[model samples]
Target: MSQDGAEFSFKKIAIPAFGPSILFGLGEGAILPVIALSARGLGASVAIAALVVTLIGIGSLLSNIPASILTDKYGERWSIVGAAGLSMVAMILCAVAPNLWVYGLGVLLIGAASAVFNLARQKYLTEAVPIQYRARALSTLGGVMRIGVFIGPFIGALAINFFQLAGAYWVGVVAVVIAGLVALSMPDLVHEGGAQSATGAPTVRSILVDRRRIFLTIGIGVLLVGAVRASRQAVLPLWAEGLGLDASTTSLIYGLSGAVDMLVFYPAGKVMDRRGRAWVAVPSMLLMGISLLLMPLTTGALGLLLVALLIGFGNGIGSGVVMTLGADYSPARGRAQFLGIWRFLADLGSFSGPALLSGLTAVISLAFGVAATGLIGLAAGAVLWYWIPRSPKTPS
Candidate 1:
């Protein structure tokens, strides 16, 4: 490449992507908190609310490849715009839906929006960063994105409390639109190659077929991610209300956790760059599992805040290490599809963890539900611990 060829910076992309990314991240984080309550407000039962999450997961699973193909065929910019546009529609539909069945369609669309937006965003990152710096670059991006998420729910809660359900929906629409527009402003990476986006015509089928173990690992990571997230996003709102707190406070707690993620995420990435992927990810996962185990026993905000810190720290490692590893393992061709494999399962975990854990509490107890999820996370860490191949670290 010529020295005069175009180059990118964190400010170049991160600044524009930040707004949309935040909207996307926040929606990713907050919906779990709101879904059950919103359903109940529309007169759905606990059983059905659980089903709502399951259905969303199904939609995410269905949309993964199509989203990748669309990104490849059209371009990353349009893919995100299309997704955000659909999400705007979905949220409005969700607010107005008269019945659970129609509401389910809204949920499906929301999941689909995430699929495309995520693919575009990741492809953007892959195209923008150099290989030596890729891990930290992705980590920095994750940290920023998490900051967006951290801000969203707190504001959403204020809207929910001040203006009721419609207010919350309105806030979400604005966020989706903002994110979409920012995506529009960014430059597109037309040609995919080198350390950045993939080059060549490898089939998505080959990537998925040969990397079954990696896919499994991704699934487990997603489950744990979604599992830990569900505890806060899906179940915590209900738990908080049961404790007699308002929606505002619940959002604050969620927001605080997001803040913690932002603060620690970059530092964690640096450690991964210096130490190694497994070195950081392994301990982060263990801490995350331990934090989940601790959540049920802690009844006070202070205790919960500490738990959030631990969980956030663990997540910081994962957000960096996992993406770095994904980029490393994935061949230059069909990178989006491989990242989709990474994201697809995690989204499944995100959708499933809340509902499944909450549903389990019906037969047992919330304490048991939290504990079960935490234990599963420990197993996930162990799995990654055993199998994550060590790659040669690039010179700084």
Candidate 2:
């Protein structure tokens, strides 16, 4: 309310939180690519490896609503700390697991923990950050995440060389422990108004019943976008390997793409805030679609590298766009619940995408998987083009 309080800088307030955020990203990045690879190495087929990778999304989908409920009940601090701790435990399990089934369970736990951690963090940011700066703040958060992810795989590559693929899980364990420690020691920033309804406490059923139109329309588009994005992560290493690229080169190329994505993070947010979210969302989808199409055409490392760069550029331009939009549409009352449903749809899409791709690859060919994602991306762009402009500016 006072002039001095208004001048309190986000940079100072967010530093402690940033540490955990980046570390979490690093841990996920280091371990996730290797999950599928590890599964394949453990005698699973390519399709089975993809199923293992999809478990993360499936776990997140299962946990989203529960995560929101926990955050609303307990607040961000405990939710994050507990989730980080669970992530560390899951990493340890993955490291020592004797079979693909056990490793998949660990990965599933990581995903569930991730859902809780991410929802809590997003809730905190939505409540604490000023509206004028919201997009940029979220985008910068995405950038911080991108930075760790970009750096993680390179280190993971080294770890794999020295200690084998499971070594990546060790790196993840360290990163998760560091993140949990940082988060535990940090001060909790309390916001003025908690996300509760004016009439009474809101239930997920009520929110869905009330916002069904927006949920079905723009939500579908969001789902498709999330699907394409998740497919990119799940398919890339497998695709590269299928094309005969070595592990180190694949990691390097993927890391470089992440670098490109990080570069545009802030700018993407700026564009969204200034020109409306559509400006970024539509273009990103189009670019991503083009990249997916080109992916199947890649014959070697260089060609894969080119597609990776395009996917990075596409992904970069939409940094934080999903969260920004989620915040924009969420009712201040019951924010977490709304986000829970929002993210559930997205996570469902993410799970189904890779599963669908794996099925398509098994039935037809990898090229069909690529073509399907390309088609989905293009369709998603069209949905955004039509839906975003007509949506109400304020939460109902």
TM-score of each: 0.81, 0.87
lDDT of 2 by residue, 1-396 (tens): 111436646776476667888998999989876988888877899979968877877788999999989987888878988899989888888888888888889989999999998888777776666665667778887788878876677678789899998789888888878887777755566643554455578788988998898889999999999889988986789889898888899989987887788899888877776777888889999999989988888899998898999999999998887787888888876788999999998888887787788889989998898889988999989998888863224433
Worst lDDT run of 10 residues, candidate 1, spans 1-10
**Which portions of model 2 miss their true places by more than 4 Å?**
1-8, 37-49, 98-101, 157-166, 185-199, 234-252, 296-304, 390-396
Residue-wise C-alpha lDDT for candidate 1, range 1-396, written one tens digit per residue: 001114645565666655577777766555545777888888888978867866666777789888887887677788888999999899899888898888889988888887788777777666566665566767876776677666666678888888787666777788888888878887766563544333446557877887777677655764565556545555455556556667778777766666666677677766666666777767777887788788888777667767776776676666656567666666556777777777776666676676678678888988788777788778768876776645434422
The count of backbone overlaps in candidate 2 is: 0
**Alpha-carbon local distance difference test for all models:** 0.70, 0.83
Q: Highest TM-score: give the candidate number.
A: 2
Model 2 RMSD to the real structure?
A: 3.3
Model 2 lDDT at residue 396: 30
